[model samples]
Target chain A: MDNVASLMHGFSVALTTHHILLMMAGVLLGILVGVLPGLGAPNGVSLLLPLTFSMDPVSAIILLTSLYWGALFGGSTTSILFNIPGEPSSVATTFDGHPMAKQGRATEALSFAFLSAGFGAMAGVILITLLSGWVAKFALKFSSPEYFAVYFMTFASFIGLGGASPLKAIVSMGVGFALASIGMDSVSGNVRLTFEFDALLGGVSFLIAVIGLFGIGELIITMEEGLKFEGVQAKVRISDVLRTAAKLPRYWVALLRSSLIGIWMGITPGGPTAASFMSYAMAKRTSRNPAKFGKGEPEGVIAPETADHAAGSSAMLPMLALGIPGSATAAVMMGGLMIWGLNPGPTLFTDRPDFVWGLIASMYLGNVVAVIVVLATVPLFASILRIPFAIIGPIIVAICFIGAFTVASKSFDIWLALAFGVVGYLFKKLDYPIAPLVLAMVIGDKAEDAFRQSMIFSQGSLSIFWSNALVSTLMAIGVVLLLLPLVGMIAQRLRGRTAQSTV
Target chain B: MITRFWAESATAVATMAFGLIIVYGALEFGIGWDSSGPQPGAFPFYTGLLVALASLGTLALTIGRRIAGNAGLQESFLDAERFKRVASFFLPLLAFVVLSVTLGMYVATILYLVFAMRFQGGYGWLPSLATAFGAAAFFYLALEKFFQIGLLKGPLEPLLGL
Candidate 1:
């Protein structure tokens, strides 16, 4: 009942004309960013972040989150039409989406993708509404040890379940932590890692890193591939859209199962990309005609799209409630929260219910707006891909450098962005996961603060982590998650030895 | 041509050097914990150490794989054709950055767009010029006029000012 009342109040706060207009504009810009290659959800959000510096927190968040919803939908547009995924999460959509387009069922495939994605996003929002209150209240009892434990669990899960090599993951994460620890240390007021350079006073900005890595880095790869958008021209008819929407309820089972998978992954650290891939795999395994999966199957289009949007929306919960982002885009948003003079944690709910609940209510409204807007504007966005990459590519590069310059208006950041661009390209090519690095940079200082605070409480005794049951349980889970991969590898090797002996 | 083994090994070495640099910088501050708690350098010291050690592990793994005659590691990381494409794109981007600092961003934006669209893309001169000028104007109006943010400016803007 309390949650419902709070939601109603949130609706009132978010229902103004100003907020709705922002949602529409955000979704439109988001779709543009999504339609273009090399500009993803994270890069798009960061690009718009500087523009939002002057707005109120609620309006800012509403715009950013709406753009995210729009970007997810836009990513699917490219997948179905051009056989290229605009966003990493939409790669699975290409399997059946392009096939459907090739079969002249582009309208049906697109309608199914959009409708099911809306459904998944709604399910995720509902879950957030129901659980946010409990999570916030539970987190209010947390101390430094518990906070550190939460961060530990996040990083540990990323390593154990990230599917990246453990050594590379550690190096990536360590570099992030080291970069974050530059400049003045708040606890002791000592400048660490400056190397006597005056520009090191502010440390490396994560925004610069993001632009260089995801923006310029991605552009370089696209150039190397010599990408051309020879796409199927989608002629969407209202009747076809209506027919597809009508048939959507027939796949209620897949929708429900995928929503569960998406929500689970979103709350954990599997993120939207992982969630989409996993949901696609699950749908294939459970289908009666699994062989029809990559062959213009509607279920194939529906599964990954639903899971992608669901995970994208639900991942906001941990970022809002616990100050831990579940994805790179969410990490950028959390960085935005800090810049807005708002600390993301349990206190945010009590201190500013209007901001928290208003943002949540806006999520419900944003997805509805996204689905409708995307449905009406599919051809418009698809045509954007028809524009030559030569023109679009340089423009994107300019936007990236301009964005880097706007972050505190530093020329040094432009150089820094270029450096990170090279690093980003190398890292991507080498299969070193970039999410852990971004996540580490975002929370690195906070994790250090929590650890140092806990150490003070325990007088540097490491046993403080296990002093309380809550903290101990959190630490125990972290340890298990950290060791799970190693255990699996060892077990596999042992099984291989046994099989060899039997042979 | 570069093989995957060399690329992996070089990257490992670079990361290891980065980690060691951090470690050296961290040593300037006391890495030891005191009664007051952790020193300023303690956190970075450990993180740097972790990075260095993990990078060494990666290096070792790469060497072991190479020793085992891994076919995948022997594949070309970048062939000549791919290198040419990447270089053409990267060199202009490098020029754009240098111009952005010395010249203004707006000027660099126009020049870079023109070069890419006209010379590289083989578009007509009219369209390339239109796009180049249009992008600069749009950015100027949107960023400078609307957003009230000043971008990097050079000698040209001052002479043309009212």
Candidate 2:
């Protein structure tokens, strides 16, 4: 009952004439960024983050969240049209989307994708609306130790389940934590890593790091490919969209299953990319015509599209309800919340129901608006890909440098951005996971503070983490997850030895 | 010459060096448990130790792994053509930064665009100049006039009273 009432209030705020205009604008920019190769949602949001500093927090959040939705939709546009994934989450979409386009079913594939995305996002929003109250109530009981345990789980998940080597992931996260400790320590008032440089006093901003790592680093690689742009031309009719919408009901089972997979992954630390891949693989494995999966299967297109959007939207629930971001993009948004002087977590639900509800309402409205807007403008965005990459490459580079400078209006940040860009390029080349690094950088200081506070509460006793059942279970799960990778490797080795002996 | 293995090995060595440096620094702040509870350096101390051990493990595994076939111990980091292409953009980016500081942001952006389009993109001067000037004008209006944010201005801005 309260959720319904709050959602009604949320709709009132979100439907205002001015707020609606902001949503339209955010979604448009988001789609534009999403359609562009190499500029993903994280890079787009990071570049635009500094601009939100001047606006009211509520309005700013509406714009950013709407942008997120738009970007999620936009990534699919390129995948179906050009056989290129504009964002990582959309990679699975390309498996079937591009094949459909090659078979001259581009319009049908695109319409199916947009409709599935809309359904998935709405399903995710509904889940968030229902479970958010319970989550908030549960989280209200948490203390410093529980919060620290949650943070530990997030990092541990990345190490054990990130699909990368645990050593590489830990090394990357360690580097991020070390970088995070550069700024002034709030508790002790000591600066550790500045090394006496005046520019080092304020510490490194994650926005700069993001823009550098994703935006500029991506530009460098694009340049290495010789800055070429060539993609399939697209043309969609209104009838095509309607026809696909009608046919979409036949795939309701796939959509529902994918949404469920997406929501689970989003609520955990696995994130949208994992959800999309898992959903697509499941769809293939269970299909009557598995061989048709990568050869323009409509179910293949629908499955990943639904899962990606569902995962993207549901990822916000954890960020809002637990103060722990579930994905890289959510991590950046969490940094924005801190910048606006608002701490995320259960307290936010109680203290600022207006902001929380308004954001929720906007998600509902944003997806509806995005589906309509993106469906109508696919041709326009597809034409954008016709522009030469050499022309767009330098312009993006200029924007990155300017965006870095604008973060603090400091010239020093631009330099740091360039340095990080070089490091980012190397990391990518070496196949090291950058997401863990970004997450660790964002949460390192807070995690350390929580750990110290827990120790203080327990008078230096390590048992404080186990003093309560909730914290103990949480810590136990984190430890098991941390060790799971090593266990898996040993188990694999033993199996190999046994098989060799039998042979 | 660098192969995948050698590159990973180098990264491990660098990680170890960074870990040692951080651990050494944490020692200066004291890693002991004080009367209040844990000291400031306690957490960082553990983080540093983790980094050092992880890097050492990576180094050991990378060294022990055997290379197959005739690819040899070292693999070229990049083909000659790929290296050239990367350098072409990278050198320009560094120049963009240097020029932004001296020539101001707008001036640097315009010049960088024009130069890239002409030399790197193999385009005639007209379209290059038009796009360069147009982007600068758009940003000036959007960022400066509407957003009311001040950007780095060159001597030319005052001469034109921008």
Candidate 3:
């Protein structure tokens, strides 16, 4: 009860006039960004980092995190109304969503998606509020060994749960960690990797890496496919969606199931796409009418849409709670947190209780705003699908270049941005999962420091990892996560061999 | 798809070599004098090791799977026609980066818009030129005049220094 009241105090700060205005602006801007190709919630948040430097920590976090939530919501609009998935998380929506639009069920599909997404996101926020206290207590008990072990498991699991082969994910992460070590060393204060290049002195900037891997990479891939929009031409109205004319209560099972799928993926760092695909698969298998899936089935659309939104929104959990980002956008938000001079962790819930909880409260507020704004304006953004990609192409490029230059107000950063654009193109061509690289770079340094500091604190004792009960438990879980895939493969092979022998 | 996977896998293998060189290079300056905190090489060395090990494992596993009769990597998410359109405009975008630093953002943008619209977009010259100038003007006003951002003005700006 006391805790709830204290959280209410946090709400007072979050609901201030200035804070409210910033949240509004963030939500609006995030939607615009989400609608645009090549710009996700993360990129928009990063591009806006400079603007937050002068603001108080609470408002800064509010602005960035709200922008993040809003962008995730914004992404689904394009995915459902048109065939375009504005963010990666919304990809599954195109499977059934666009088809539903073509069949003139856009109103129902759109409304279901929005309502369930809001419900899912609201659920995620509550989970954060209730679970954060317990999670933080567990996190606070971690020493350096436990911290290193946690980082290890998270990075390793990128291979485990990231839709790629375990080996490829691991390689990508390892390379990222190496790249992270390129500048001056943090602990010993020595020049480790620069090779005497002055530009390398600052090490790789998170801005540079993200712009290259995602923004630029997408730009290249965008070129390969060229610009085309086969968006649905539907006459969807607000009332049609708001009416709840369709009795989808039976599908509530799908919606809830998908939401759980999303929240699990988000928390485990599997990301939105994972949630989308998993929920889509689960919804199909569980459906009484499986054949209807992928053929404009509203179930297909609703399942992935609800799950993606849930995953995208719930991924915020890890980012705020443990300072470990569950998705690229969340990773970018982490940078925004650093820029605002507020580090996220257990301390975030304590010292900056208002900042953390306020951000949570703002999630509720921003989600309502996003639902209203998006539902009202879906037709307008969907109309953008009609614009020729040729026209939209130049506009996106202009935004990318301009946003890149703003990072340093220097010509050099502009050049770096262009260079990254090429690298981005290459990564896309090669089929490399860009997220692991980006995510690893974001946390590589911290993870390394955590490992070394633990060692130093333990006088080079490797056994400290097992000395603490919490650390031991987490490490055991991490080891299981790492080995589970291999074990599964072995079990499958054995089953196959035994069946053949019996035959 | 299997072949393409190997091709990319090879590239990553090469990248690992580059990464190894970087790790070694960073440690050359004695990897920091051992201090109360941590030796400088300590972190970099471990990161480098992880990269080498991970990349090596990735290449090996990918190859191993191929040899084990894994026929092909499964379906790709890319849409071909959509990809083609983005590429044409994308090439010129790289060119725009070079032009911006040399010629200036405004003039470079004008050129980029013209190229993008005419070639990639298949738009008429009049609309293309109109778009080029209009875009430049809007950006100039939004970033420079309204935001008061002092962009590295073009040759034209020097003449019309307001």
Candidate 4:
């Protein structure tokens, strides 16, 4: 098909020395940020977006996208060695991974997680390459209602996950919506919060806010907690990865299921966190040995690592096909796309088939390259955690400060970074989930724009949200999903009542 | 004091208070100028209204849970030291804001970085000063020179004469 020829063209662009270098830089930085506790991939991508201004669109995307892949691989290392998850997706990995480390089987766990992540990521990329065109064509049929439904589903997933207190999650999300409103309303053209400042006229920079909230916030919280890594290092032999393959078939089902879930969630914009959580929950509930699930089960590690990678990889589909980002990191990638002066959507694919196909082909190559590099270097990175947190803490904070300033080249971002670092620390202290905050910050405005535009189309009627068959169907699903926590509560209450009646 | 009920309760009140203040702020600015062109107040006014509604709901939830004697809010959200640390960061941050408005981004950054690293983070003169200067220098060169983004013309901009 034409797809194969286009992929060949993509490889030609991706193989260029500059593109390869950019990919390498992105992957290296991504891994480093993922290994750190506070600064996740989204923050890391945002912090460095300013650098993309000078680069071609392909280079910008290669760098950021590689980082997304790198962070997925990187989060596993800390979870395996230190029992600390580098990002939310790695939380499941920690359950079994840390236990395996304590049992002197750290190498086995680490290798298992890495190989699965790499393999799953490769699978996701291949699927995206094959199916992105179809997905984009379908997306092109979407109107305002469908777009708003997509946003609603994505937002509701974050709030309805039952991770944080519902109120806190909603409040944090509301806070994001509020921050998003600070800018000039694209739909309404109102300047709500700028207060006459020209800088405010441009609206709050999502990039800047992300850096402050994730990057700087992490540093401040780390300083408060007192940076320290207390863990025993296992013998990280190079052969562990090779040895782990023998065990791969045992986790084959988890690998496949999580990868499927991840791919579905990612392309649908259900998000990496939801994908990881769903895969882990399903894996645990369905596992033969449910008792082994949470307390360091290998399946736990397999499921989430697989899902995170798949989600990270497939997230590219939306950017390539529809010009919409499925997640925050993808949004940042979209920014890079804009910087490259290469528009993303359906028309671009037709016009610049080389750019489109080359990217897809390059992703396949990049996946292979990333897996090999990560596996070979996992031991070296596991050793970095051995660095004292006191020192690491200061260095991270310094990097964050630099990252923030670089975002706008404005001192305002630096202050905002510190402010967010403090806010992050506060959020952590309160046990409020911070991911929703970050997610909300990234998508809040887009969701608002969709909502307001839909409103205007209906001339300010709420019925439009449910007027369309697809939108109504999606909204019904959303309502059911929102009731999940309440259903759990009811089930628990019924169980108690049954026991009381038995008495 | 660390009870979930109180925390939720207090947060509810704070939320309601903040929402009211925000709504009042919007009203003060003249809400929703729905001109043929986009108005400055429309988005904010709606947002302010939403905040007000959400907070009131939060308050109702808080009260309902408390009256029902549900103690499920046992998880302590904030640590004592967190507030103190927030104060430490916030002061320097506030200073950076004030300075940036007056002296522009580059100059304000130098002062914020030094103060934050040295005093706020409790680093010493050499390391903190060096860290701040190094960061600012790169930012100035990378953005101002490479990207062609002009910096605020403080004492330095006039001498360089563009």
Best by lDDT: 1
**Each candidate's chain A: what TM-score?**
0.99, 0.98, 0.94, 0.89
- List residue ranges in candidate 4 displaced over 4 A: A187-190, A196-199, A234-236, A290-297, A319-324, A335-348, A431-449, A452-456, A466-468, A483-499, B1-43, B67-162
**Over the stretch A197-267, how does candidate 1's per-residue lDDT look in tens digits?**
98888888888888988989999999999999989989778899899999999999999999999999999
- Which sections of candidate 3 miss by over 4 Å? A245-250, A499-503, B1-6, B31-38, B61-87, B145-156
Q: Alpha carbon lDDT of residue A10, candidate 3? A: 68
Per-candidate local distance difference test: 0.93, 0.87, 0.74, 0.71
Q: Regarding DockQ, does 1 or 3 come out ahead?
A: 1
Q: Residue A413 in candidate 3 has what lDDT?
A: 67
TM-score of chain B of 2: 0.82
The DockQ values of the predictions, listed in order, are 0.87, 0.65, 0.54, 0.25
TM-score of chain B of 1: 0.96
lDDT of 3 at A188: 62
Cα lDDT for residue B146, model 1? 90
Candidate 3 residue B147 C-alpha distance from true site, Å: 5.1
Model 1 residue runs over 4 Å out of place are: none
TM-score of each: 0.99, 0.97, 0.92, 0.84
Question: Residue pairs in steric clash, candidate 2?
Answer: none
Q: Which ten residues in a row have the lowest lDDT in candidate 2 chain A?
A: A224-233
Order the candidate numbers by TM-score, best to worst. Answer: 1, 2, 3, 4
The model with the greater DockQ, 3 or 4, is 3
Q: Candidate 1, residue A101: CA error in Å?
A: 0.7
Model 3 clashes, total count = 19
lDDT of 2 by residue, A103-129 (tens): 889999999999999999998999999
Tens-digit lDDT track of model 1 for B5-30: 99999999999999999998998888
